[model samples]
Target: MQPWTDRTTPRPALAALLTDVVPANRRTLILGPHAPQLIESVLAHSSDVTILVRSVSDAQQLGEDFGPCLQVIAGALDGLQTPPYDVIIASDGLDRLLGYDSADLSWTARLDAVAALATPDAVVVLGLENEFSLLNLLDSRPPHERHGDDEWRPLHDDPTRPVSVDQFRTALPWQAEVYADFASRTYVRADVASAARPGELPTRLATAAVDQTDVPLLSPAHEGLDTAARAGLLASVPTGWLAIIGAQPTHDIYTESAHTVLTATQTPTGWHLTTTPATTSDTSDTASDTTGAAGELLVFDPGVVPSTISSGVSVESVLFRLAAAEDVPGFRKLAADLGDWVTDSRVVLRWDDVVYDGESFSHGVSGWVAQETVAKEDLLAAAWARFHGRLIGQHRRHPWPPWMVGDDLVSAWLGMSGVEAPEPTPATSPDTLPVASEQVAKGKQIAQTLDDLLGITNELADLRTVLAEAEAAKHELFEMKGHVYGLERTLGFRNKAMKTRENRIRELRGQLQKMTAAHDRIRDSRTYAVSRVIFHAAQVRKPKVVARKLVRKFRKR
Candidate 1:
């Protein structure tokens, strides 16, 4: 029995790749769970095909759906006893090929087993999911896929398996074409090599891929993908890699967009570029289809022979880099050039879609045209307006003040672009010219904003904590000052009391000195002696009376 009944994941890029690699009437083997549309596409290419799915129920549905045209095996890879196939399609990878009764096999072991069932000269298109894909790294959800061992047994830490593109190339000594398969798009090496030589079609497709996704990504995928592209790691960091063994690659780069599976070609045909569609049935239209409605998207400009190469890095990407780096002067110069490019004719263009080499602006590979006539000044304002929203909304730092709102910055940018600035709009709606509404409100952009806000909230909480501490210290200081004032008053009162007591003691000492001087003068005088003698005679006549009188006199004194 299988772990899950239906484990099919739809990959349009992989499917588009299949249509190119899988030709007509070739014995092909699809040896894992894949989208039904992909399987049908393979079957349509070749009637002699074998599909091995682990789920019995899925196999039953497939058998009922396709009838006897396909050989559907509802069993493990080890159990299947079929001859080697010419073309083996395992774009779904081999991890899902595990079952209850199957032995614990490493990634390389399974690949070896699958390789054993392929002929020496067979074309094997195998997929390897990148654990380090930007989307995978930016996901904020729980990693149940890593821990869900009960359902699918993942081979962990297999040194024999390739973890990166270089390692994969090293592992496969044969000629193999590797594609960086994001779900919506895939880039070929030639297209990704050099924008000046081939073109920046890969980056253009990457930007489209970023815009089309509606998932809850942690940050803007465009920024990450752009940065990856600049760092020369875009192909190395896709959702997965498709290694086509024993055959050459098909095109420069192709994207399975919402509209069609478009392919870009860079042939020097009188300097006009052209791009073709992968398959007539799968693609809605070719990239070079110029017959689009007046206001609708165009596949590509039919004039450029190599739609993949461009003048230089996109004007839009450079402008964003300038803004992000806080390079206002550089941004203003570039903006002026962009403004010059957007006369009345090119007013509906987006900067991200255009590349500015060093000097001038080129009508880039953006597929849209202005629905109605737009003013030159209004287009400049619209461009700056979009930048303003993304700048502040994404919490990106700028040379301008944080208090400055969108209208302020937008007006400033317009002035820098040498255009007549408009009246300031106070409200901060996330809308920009092309994607203005999504500047603040888009799920991916808002998720980045949310992640930044969470960090800001923590910072604000820390500030509040410091303020609380300061308030407590302020209370302590106030109490200390009051205590000091009370001590000063008490000391003043004690000093005043001590001065009064000192004055009283000095007066008593002065009186004691004068009395002693008077007594001394009386003793020195003769009259004093006569009076003393008379008192002595009276005391002698009545000694007891005299003594009593003397005692009374002493008591009175």
Candidate 2:
């Protein structure tokens, strides 16, 4: 109502329903303001398309986008005055239109309003959420709250007012074909009659989750529910249910998907059961002329009765009932009445030597029967061997660490077997053993030999330890020897330097002696005496001249 802007891409289930049920030339009326993309897709096939919206704003937006080409009604479904439509698609909007909190409006009244707008022969498709879905079981919150719809208001103050499958079915004017939708209700799988049949429900519901790209919508705790469903559990509980109103039931049983089809048709002899792959041309063929070569068919006797197996019935009980029927006519009659008991009753049995000629088989039996035929002794022996083999295989695959061998391994093996393990025995010393008189001499000899061997072993270990220490000491000595060689080279360099200094000193001393000798020789020579006298005379003459000149000058003055 607040200008619905969340345009979810049209789910595949809705798309498939639209394509399968809606005609290209028929006038289609969409009861809710759906995604724009969905509207565009509808326009490609049908020329006359009208969408009903709750708000004027939504109508205005749609009108602006499509102009006059598409008609947008700006009112609720109850107030709309529109011509009868050939196809009407309401994607779970009826509940909202009726108002969840509106106590005055009944579902019947709301359905009547929708019926008024649809032609008598119109194909009406309605999508509704199952109140008893797996998602609801895990969470008590309403869908609007879970989906984070801030504007959502409960129809009533009570939280348990959601529309259920039974309520939805009762509101419908005609019988409808219901399907379970998965992947947030995007993909739909047929809710076949096998689901209604006892043992067959598991097979019918055992289909894989609808192919989806989104992460599964199931809680982690409920994750295994799908596998259980495939194994023939949860046939009654589906995520959601999609009801196709105005469609006639053609097949005796519906399959989860179009690909797997089961059909039962009446013939002159009896009812013929046939399983076939759905052909693109004809999807609703319950009976085909082909033999077992193309598809297998089982002919049932006309007097056979059909009975529903309770979900609580066990396989053993059913087998017991089957065996009892071998002699009792009444039991046989009852078993005959049980339609598809083997498949629908959820009884799992392994079969041996099973063959199919597209009709019946030869020497086919359940695995339980084969197991029963094996002798108890042989079975026990085989089981024991298998257990050991499994243990050996585990050991080979992931052997225990060295520390876990012997005691730890034995303890683990005992624990796995649910046995209380005893304490491990402590090793005994040789001295603790008692010696008898007769064997004392022999025992002493043996003891002496063992002691000697042990002493030798201890000595060998000590020798090895000494050898390791010696190796380390030898390495240190080698390092010391290298250090000593380096010191020697340094000392030799210093001695060479000292010798050169001594040689230089000797040369200097020799030179000094020669110079002194030369000096003495020159001083004692006649030439040296003459030269010295000349030098002294020059010196005395210069000063006497100066004195004479000074005396002559002073006298003149």
Candidate topping TM-score: 1
Residue 465 in model 2: shift from native, Å?
58
Q: Give lDDT per model, in order.
A: 0.63, 0.46
Per-residue accuracy of model 2 over 1-557 as CA lDDT, tens digit each: 55443244434324434555566777888876566655665776677889886656777899999987788876665667778998787765465452222344555666778888888888787766555655455453455555534224234433433355555566687677765554332232344322322222232222223222222233321233444454543433555556667654343323312222333332343233333433322222222321122222122121222222222322222323343344344333432322122221111121111222223322111111221133322222222222223233222223345565433443343333233344444447855432222212222232223222212122222233356668979999999999999999999999999999999999999999999999999999999999998898777848878789999999999
Instruction: Report the error of model 2 at residue 33, Å.
Output: 3.2
Model 2 CA RMSD to the hidden true structure, in angstroms: 30.3
Q: Give the Å error, residue 45, model 2.
A: 3.4
Give per-residue CA lDDT, model 1, range 38-120, as digits (tens): 88779888859889988888899889988998888888887877888999998877777867788878887788788888898
- lDDT at 1 for candidate 2? 54
lDDT of 2 at 207: 26
Best model number under lDDT: 1
* Model 2 weakest lDDT span, ten residues long: 344-353
